[model samples]
Target: MPSASLSVKGRISMINFNTMNLRQENNIRRRFIMKKAARFLVVILSMMFLWGCELALIGIGASVGVGTYKFIEGKLERPYPIELQKAWDATNTALTNLQISVSGSLLEGAKGNIEGVRKDGVTVYISLKDEGQKVTTIGVRVGTFGDRIEADLVHKEIAAAAGL
Candidate 1:
């Protein structure tokens, strides 16, 4: 099969006529450069904002760790065993200040075990007493994903601390 072609000519106005003059070309180039600069500025500003947020978070963690430790020391009742009392004292010191102080207790028979719940920044893990009197083990389990103590993690932390 042979295809027949038809040819016609007029003013090719349908095509874009961009290469008219040097001034027009420069204007277009300037516009492109301005757009790119604006985009770069936006990106740099976004990065700076994120970096600032990260620094703020670190500062908060340090403040919480110190303040919570002090708060715990102030709250405990006297007359408990020296070792058990000291464990509580140390646990509070170790926690971040952002901790919500959900609930905590020391088990009767187990002198060293103590449990505590705190937000501790982003993730919520139940802090429990390890076998040793000095170290408090953080449970891998996460608490309820929200801002409350309804999560099963808190209950488990309490039970573990209470020696149940």
Candidate 2:
């Protein structure tokens, strides 16, 4: 009888130990899963936040008649619904009107660049690419880095000159 009692007690203790280990293991796995979920959520939210400005710009451009543009690196680019030749001529006129002295220029069949210097000695570069018929995209940059105000001014002048 005594031996039987000791064996039963040992079995009961083993069962308790096993149950405790299982509980602890389950808790660790739950915590790991929770941590992963939290990290994923943070990454998703951060991406959305980063894209907020781009989305807003798209919406604004869509609302306006001017198509969407992308500011890449230091260049602010825009598209005009005009022929490449028209756009090129308008660019020159715009720079001349803006009092930016043309330093150098190049015009190929589908790509071209116009470099000039403002009175303030800030270098301005305007690049043109033919997208399709009556569609030309222009990328403008001011100085070595970039100047949004100057770039925008250039774009605005180009648009006006192109009758866009």
Candidate 3:
């Protein structure tokens, strides 16, 4: 038969073993939680990095677009006519292509003439007035060498006519 001291000692050892097992389980649980938290942080950081890249790209696109617009605007000059018909044709094209809609009388009254001679060419001066009796005012001037500078010239003329 075991002595009382031996029995008490055995019971204490068993209790200690159980306590160690419980501690091991708790440690495993803590490690699992830490791993999940780490993964969550990585995902969040990745998303933020992607968003930052997209914003940077958008900024670059806007800068490029603005630069292109300014460059085109710089190349444009007022249209000059070599002949009367050329001046009249340019003016008519500008009026026809106008974005704003006005009455027939207003369109009819929009007239242009080869006003002066410049070193580059003939300067065609176009005018628009409210001939519609309903108080409609529209006018634009387009200058071109009848070549590649047409679109920008048209835009400048329209903007000038609209007082923009």
lDDT for each residue of candidate 2 in 8-125, tens digit (9 for 90 to 100): 7789999999999999999999999999999999999988888847555434322433456777888998877777899999999999999999999999999999999999899999
C-alpha-based local distance difference test score of model 3: 0.42
Q: How many backbone clashes are present in model 3?
A: 3
- Best prediction by lDDT: 2
Write down the worst ten-residue block by lDDT for model 3: 64-73
- Model 1, 66-134: lDDT tens digits are 111111211211121124444454444444333545355444533434344555534443333333323
- Write the residue-wise lDDT of candidate 3 on 9-118 in tens digits: 78999999999999999999999999999999999999887873633432332132211222222232222212323334444555455432222321233333223223
| C-alpha lDDT values of all predictions | 0.40, 0.85, 0.42
Runs in model 3 lying further than 4 Å from the true structure = 1-6, 55-164
User: TM-scores, in order shown?
Assistant: 0.25, 0.62, 0.31
Higher-scoring candidate on TM-score, 2 or 3: 2
| Ranking of all candidate structures by their lDDT, best first | 2, 3, 1
Better of 1 and 3 by lDDT: 3
